[model samples]
Target: MKTLALLSAAALTTTLLATPAHAAVTQWGACLPGQGVDPRQECTTIEVPMDYSAPGGPSVTLAVSRIKTARPEVRRGVLLIIPGGPGSPGLNRPSTLVKKLPQEVLDRYDIIGFDPRGVGKSSPVSCGLAPADLSLTRLKPYPDADGGIAENAAWSRRIAEACARNGGPLIRHISTRNHARDIDRIRAALGEEKISYWGVSYGTYAGAVHATMFPATTDRVVLDSNDDPDPRKVSRQWLANYAVGVEDSFPDFGVWAAARDSDYGLGADAAAVRKTFLDLAARLDREPLAWPGAKPEQLLTGNLLRETLLNALYSTANYPMLAGLMKAALNRAELPMPNQPEEAALQNTAAHAGATMCNDIEWPNSIARHEQQVKRNRAVYPLTAGMPVNLGPCAYWPFKPAEQATRISSRGPANVLLIQNLRDPSTPYSGALKMREAFGQRARMVAVDSGGHGVYLANGNACGDRTVTDFLVTGHLPARDRNC
Candidate 1:
């Protein structure tokens, strides 16, 4: 799958009809059959076109799941949870959130989740990449020692070519605009006149597009960990911003590493911890160490160290894992083993993620341009090295985008709510502000003074969680932006 967590992972309208094109009667059935479906959860599938331009052509089924409110008398339609990771699984999201959300959220609406096209259980696509190529270091364009990008460029071409060869026609259709259109279809399938949405990370962009494209049918929209909808630069902007985001978040990691009283013994303080990390990374660059159980060869290089840091930075809960890895590396002992994703599942994720990113917009094809950008970014943002601006499969994407990217605007209804963490690494507060500005008067933001990516229910901030829950349940908005 994609290494970038951000690329990691809406709507109802009822008018009148019971035909094939109309809303299909959702025959709720057993969910997650082999994966232990909850008694309260029900599952079903809906058919959508491989290409919307030819709606009558080939179609793909999207898996959907729902947990209806226990109190039907006060039920307020459906609340769709939009997942992050353009490739992250979502059919089980309702199951995951059911335990985390307050009863108020679970009681007010039927919680819904689904796997998008080209993802799990939804007519999946796969590039069939070799296990070595699928590793995090190779997935992201981390340059080789001496700052050479020859291997990165070759890998980028290989990935792009593999997707083109194996991903089929559906690959080109996997994009944000089409994703928004699919949401309307899902809305119809649910037979709801209007639906509320709770979207985080990349889902925020999808939810925003759905609201923009079908404002009249949107209700109580919540966009958390926003993305910059710069029409010209969609995922490209997100990829580039990781340099800044990583630098912004590394201090938190440093503080945590310094405070630990365990075997990591990274440093006595934040500054020293950062220095230790830098020294370790430089040493790894010079002499890559073996890490048994790691795919291909178990080599721990500088790139892997940086990737581990980025992965661990997503949540405070993951700090210890990185520390453990650091300790193992420091002692030159066996490193902590990682749970490798199933080969087939990983292929599907990579195909979906790479196809969607490339199909969304054309990326710069000039390796020279990327080389310059990477060099400049590396100098300015040493925490991320040059990976943020380095070449990836997008640079050699086989197909041009199917359509122009959607331009987000404030022309939609004033039903949007933006929730953001001030120091998010993936979707930084700076980018969230751009999304907020794009919505203009259409949205009121709830800024949480947090360090992680997601906010609202997941951030453990009561003020933010209450603001979103109350809005969904009672259709109220703050007069202005509120900071928690």
Candidate 2:
């Protein structure tokens, strides 16, 4: 449900580029102040047009960071690490990856990260949404028992209106295509002839588009936990796939919960554990539980349980948390404390998700179609309650997309390596295959026998990590797609 941060920083010293707004230069300075700031990391800024079509128009500043190797004698080139969520900023990515990445990888290239335009330190966009409306349950619609989305439609209109009112011209330009263009600008600012890239989740799509549009400029490309690059669907398909992904991932949690000698003591078998979960969810739906220090309904209902489960499946480490939550709820026990993000941060994240998704392409405005899809999805995948197929702010988005979604092609240089988990709860193996097929022979995939969203250096098997790191260091892709 949340994209992890991989951003690290470099300090800044601004210098004007000889080129116009589209090709501004980067100026390096010291890391101002933040967590996990390494002395090795430098912070800088790159200016790109708010709209690429109008290169001479007003520009927006993108906050960029990099961690360069100590041994420049061995430095190969720049490695741009793209962040997911379109909303997620990458300024902190390098700090986290630096500790886990092989020294050889660190020695070979400077790892660069940035807050995508309209995110984080970059020129941001906000809807000024109410705190109640910013809740996750509210941001993602959960239909009523009648399977009607009347309320969701209302919320969508309100959200869209708010965003249109508050998010300036910049919001309209936060598409994947613009994001790809931003990456190229970063490359030019770094003065790199060609750059390597590692992109995860949404980052994978942006990287793929970059590779497609500017193949000659790409050196090494690694796409992890990929999304389906179906040009016609884009984020809509990614959202819908959540239903399938949750179904595939839930069993892993069930198996863990039912393991022999499990300390949680929810059930003796996987079936029994699932039953316990379903029973509790039904009970909550009938009688929502009061939750202190929570907002929007401030009640624990079945939908929240479903949403929590979906979020928990992002990492195996969250299995215990979900299990404990269930156990507490089933005992009529007090729920464990929930972690809440600040209201402003939530607003920013929602704005980014909306702006980027809506700006990428048009979503169907037909409530009837959305209702049919939700009802069908609920029947087929009850675990997710059709939330994945429900209407979002994009349904009522005000502006037409500035550009059509990019169609990923095998027309790129043969330099891409994709690593995916067999049962990723967010970007499942099924969707990953689509991205792999989209790239064709231009890419090779390493399917890890794992279950989680992120792949390399986070949730993937060591073999997958080794394959990616090796590709980064030596530019050697697997002879064929390999499973780990």
lDDT per residue (tens digit) for residues 1-484 in model 1: 2222223321111121122434484488887454545677888888877787876677777788999899898898999988776777688788778887888878888999998887887777788787888787786778886677889999999999998887777778899888888788888889888989899888999999899889889988999999888889898988877787777788888888887846589998888888888888888999999887777547889888888888777788878888888888888988888745666666777888788789889998888988888888878877678988888999899898878888788997788999998777788888889999999999999998877778876653999989988898888999899999
lDDT, candidate 2, 1-484, per-residue tens: 3411111222222322223654545468886677777777888887888878878777888888889887799999988889887677788778878988899999988989888887777877788887777766776788865577998999999999999998777778888898898899889888888989999999999999999989999999999999999999999999888888988887788889989326777788877877777778778888888877666558888888877887788888878778887878877788887766666566777888889899898999899999999999988988878888999889999999988899899986789999999888778889999999999989999999988889998888788889998999899899999999
For model 2 the TM-score comes to 0.95
Score each candidate by Cα lDDT. Answer: 0.81, 0.83
Candidate 2 displacement at residue 240 in angstroms: 0.5
- Please identify model 1 stretches exceeding 4 Å from their true place: 1-23, 34-36, 261-263
Error of 2 at 460 (Å): 1.0
TM-scores of all predicted structures = 0.94, 0.95
What is the model-wide C-alpha lDDT for candidate 2?
0.83
